[model samples]
Target chain A: MRPVADVLIVLALALVAASSTAAVLARDPVRQSTVLALLGLSLALLFAVLQAPDVALSQLAVGSALTPLMLLLSVRKVRRKGKEGGSHRNAGNRTGSTDQEGRR
Target chain B: MNGWLSAAALLLLVGFAPTVWGAASGPVRRRVMAQNLATLAGCLVLLLLAQGYARPSYVDLALVLAVLGPAGTLVYARLLADELAERPARDPVARALGRAMTPLAAVCVPLVVLPLCVATGPGRAMVKLLAIGALLIGGNIVSTRALSARHATGHTPRGTGHTPQATGPERHTTGGQSGAAGG
Candidate 1:
């Protein structure tokens, strides 16, 4: 980098790049949410260094808290749904033969 | 880069890299702590960057982070409580991690914020910086307490904190799942 700002910006970019790569590689949404939060932090810093406070502010709000909360909520809801589905499937199997006889 | 920017760069290099690595590769419990550490480190970096760039307005970014970072962690602790609770206390690593890192963060975050407060000087911005510092530190305390409470109850099983966690599923509910992970 030619100067300090350029160097800081580059560092922020590197932080973003590294964490984003990790986020992509992570299959677990829980882990991915953590990495994504780190990515958001670096991105916000990048924006702030680049003189985009407005962008940084919005990014901070969404990235630091909102995105992770959303991801965790969805993960919880999905897990709960899976459990419910499993129970329903077991119930269906128990009545499978009776239902077949009724159809005949 | 000047001293401030240099410090920012150094913090990014030394501090955040490990948090990213920890958050990325570890078990969910470890990842949550790493994520919290990232917020603390990220705030310090932003504060340094603001001072380095002489853009007091840039502190807004840090302020927002201070407010949201722990808030995010608490959200994870709340939502992930069930999943996390299922994991039992056998993993010494996670327990050690919780024990070691909590004090480190409690001390380190404010250590970083204090100088930024001094450098920021006496003004509305200084007051804002102090408020941000207070929020960041205060939020970290509450969330850390919440995390410890969850772990103490979930892991210890016989601990006093267990009853409330059981009775309340909405706010601070914790389960006892041991099959998942210690990272």
Candidate 2:
């Protein structure tokens, strides 16, 4: 039993290491969010193997779902803002150029 | 070193590892699909662990995962709708996975749950085990449908206005209905 538990723990820890690395290495925020969710799932499994069910439950909720959801929502909001900002800047430049012509 | 523990270990190596790889490096559609698969695998591992440790209380982790897994996938599907639409998952691997989802769940849920049910014998615990199995399958189907290209293309045209919001609620209601039936 001890050996089996050890095996599970080691395997889970390896998964955590690999997933965390992958999450960090992922370039796209969207992809990173997905990898981050996998990291949470692996972490929860590790907690379960370590005989901490309560911690596993909370980790599952916050790590797997909540964290990724927040990340993705932030990415969406930022992208939209960037798009609007670019267009607004273009419009402002256009108006400035026309005003300079009018003054001349 | 019980059989349940050994099985869980094997699943962690075989079922879960590939999902980690899949999610780590792939197209957005495949990564999302892999994330969904990881949740299913995670839920099953928790179930096996619950039985392996002889602590029925641990089953709640699996139960919670059963509910939250698909919901998380749905969030990805909704929020990443534009990306998914721009580059649809038309690859053979993604298509194969989408096609295999139902059959895989159909085989796995019973193969894992039936033995656990027998080991547990007939009781509330057994019923709860069964409910988790049902949720696992239902959620898999719902999320697979939600992630498929056809669904993305169908919803992408009306991406603005209330269409995205409406589709999210509509899918949620369908998931709720499935949960009701499963429970």
Candidate 3:
């Protein structure tokens, strides 16, 4: 019983480590949020293996759902802002350069 | 050491590892699909763990996961509508996964939950387990339907004609409609 439990704990720990690393290394913010959710799931499993049901429950709520949702929302906001800003800057640059040429 | 623990461990290796890999590096569609799969796998693992540890109370964890997992996937499907529209998940692997999602849920729920119910016998606990299983299968079906529906709608307008001007608003309208339906 002890040996099997130890094996389960180790497997879960490995999953946690791999997922956390993947989350950090992910290039796209959207992909990162996805990986982060998986990371949360793995961590909750690890906590469960460690006999910490209370922690696992909270982790399940926050890590799996809340954190990823937050991350994805923020990413969406930033991308929208960036798109608007880029178009605005391009317009400003074009107009400003033409105005300077006319004055010159 | 126990059969339950061994089962959990086996599932961890077989069921979850690929999902982690799939979620980590893939197209957004695949990643989202993988994340959904991870949640399902995670919920099952919790159930097995509860049995392994001889703590029925721990089933609550699975219950919470069962409820929350599909909600998260729906959130992704809703929020990432534009992205999903821009690039349809037409890749063979994504299509295969999307096709498999429902059948997998249908099969796995029974495979895992029946044994659990047998172990638990006829009681409130057994009922709770059955409820979780139902929720899991139902959630999986809804989410997969949402995903495939979104994919179909996202692709149709563009496929019919390549006019960017024509498809842009059309795509948005379709995406909006699907989002409403999914929500």
Find the candidate with the highest TM-score and give its number. 3
lDDT digits (tens) for residues A1-96 of candidate 2? 778888999999999999999989998798899999999999999999999999999999898678888999998787778768774643553576
Q: Give all TM-scores, in the order shown.
A: 0.79, 0.83, 0.85
Q: Which candidate is the best by DockQ?
A: 3
Clashing pairs in 3: A4-B1
Question: Which portions of model 1 show Cα errors greater than 4 Å?
Answer: A87-104, B88-97, B158-183
Question: Which structure is stronger by DockQ: 1 or 3?
Answer: 3
Clashing residue pairs for model 1: B30-B183, B85-B175, B85-B176, B85-B177, B86-B176, B86-B177, B86-B178, B87-B177, B88-B178
User: How good is model 2 by TM-score?
Assistant: 0.83
Quality of candidate 3's docking, in CAPRI categories? acceptable
Q: Give the per-residue Cα lDDT of candidate 1 at B144.
A: 62
Each prediction's Cα lDDT score?
A: 0.75, 0.84, 0.84
Give the B-chain TM-score of model 3.
Answer: 0.85
lDDT of 3 by residue, A54-75 (tens): 9999999997668877888887
**lDDT per residue, candidate 3, B1-183, as tens digits?**
299999999998999888999988867888888888888888898999999999999999999999899888988888887656555675666778888987898898789999999988999999999999988887877777777667866776656765577556755765674464345
Candidate 1 lDDT: 0.75
Using DockQ, rank the candidates from best to worst: 3, 1, 2
Residue range B120-148, candidate 1, lDDT tens digits = 77889888887877776666656665666
DockQ result, candidate 2: 0.39
